[model samples]
Target: MRVMVALIATSATYLVMQVLRDEPEIALEMGGTYEDMLLQSTAHFSPLIPGHIWFRVPKTDARLRFIDTQYGFITPAARFFTVSFNDNVITNIRMSPQIEPLLLDDVLKVVLDLQDQWRANGWTVMYPRDNPPFADTPEWRAKLRDVNKGGITFWQAGDKYQVFLDMGRFRDSKRPNEERYLITLALAKPWLPTQVE
Candidate 1:
C-alpha cells in the first residue's frame, strides 16, 4: 500500500508540472479561442463578469498557480489579468499590476518589454516616431498626461493587429474616494478599439 501511494503521488506531481508549464508569451497572442487558451496555459480562469475571464500567475512553489503571474518571492505582480472574448474568440487580453500609483519608469519598462515580445512575434512600433530612452521626469509625466488624453501607446503588425499600452486612472469599487493609477496592456484585432475606461 505504501509503495502504491508513492507511485501515485509521483505521477500526480509530474502531471501538475506538465500542466502548469510557462506558455503565457504565446497564450496572449490574439485570435485564439477559449479552448486554445485553456490548452496553452492549462490555468484555471475565473469569470470576472459575463464576457471576461481572469487568471493570476501561479507561484513557483504552488502547483495551483500559473507560471506567468509571479514576481519576486511569491509576490503576484499581476492583479487584474483578464481575457475578453467575443463569440468564443478571444478579442483582447488586459493586465494590471498589483502595485498602486503606477510609476512612469516602471510602466514604460513594462510597455517596452511587451513591445519586445510583440516584435518577436512579427509586430512593429508604428507611432511616436522615436523609441524609448524615455525620460522619466515630473515634467515628462505631466506632458504625457497632457498630450495623450487616454494615456495610451500602441504598435501595429502590418494591417493585421494592434497592441496598446495604457497608463490610466483606476478607481476601486470598494474605496470610491480613492483613485489609483495603473498600467494596462492590451492586444486586440483591428475592429476592436482598445479604449481606456
Candidate 2:
C-alpha cells in the first residue's frame, strides 16, 4: 500500500515537471503583440554593455552603431546588429557576429540556438533550400553561388511576422575565414495586408 502511494506521488511529480517544462519562459509583452515587443526592443541605441533593451519602434531615422569611444573607432570582433522601421513598424533587423578564427561549427551552433528560441516563441521556421522565396531571381542565384561553404538561409512565414536568416559568406570581399551571419526579422501591421490586393 505504501509503495503504491509513493509510486503515484512520483508519477504526479513527473507529470507536473513535464507540464512546466513545456511552458515558454519569456512571455510576449506589450499586450502580447509581436510588433509591440519588437518596436519596444529597437527604439533606443542601447549599448551592449550589460542588459538588452526592448521598446516600441522610434519615429524618424535612427541607427545604432557601436563604436569604441576611447579608441574612436568601431569595436573589432564584436557582434553588430541594426534595426529598421517603416512608419513606426518594424521592417528589418540585421545581426552580424564578429569575424574571427572561431570554428565554423561553433558559430553555427549559436545561430541555431537563436533559431530554436524563435521557433519556441511560435515563429514558423524554414530552411531556404527547402522553401526558396526567390529561387529564380538573379540576386538569389548570385547569393546561392557561395552557399556551398556553410552558407544557409532560414525564412519565417506568417502574416504577423517574417524573418530571414542568411548565414555564411554572400559578399565578394568577405574572406573565407570571416563569419558574416545575418538575421533579419520583419513585422507588418495586422491591419495591413502584406500582399497587394
Q: Local error of candidate 1 at 70, Å?
A: 25
CA RMSD for every model?
Answer: 10.6, 13.2
lDDT of 1 by residue, 89-140 (tens): 6666555634445444666565556555555655555455432222457654
Provide the overall lDDT of each model, using Cα atoms, as 2-decimal numbers: 0.51, 0.40
Flag clash pairs in model 1.
57-69, 58-65, 58-66
RMSD of model 1, in Å? Answer: 10.6
Range of the 10 consecutive residues with the lowest summed lDDT in candidate 1: 66-75
> Worst 10-residue stretch by lDDT in candidate 2?
67-76
As a TM-score, model 1 comes out at 0.52
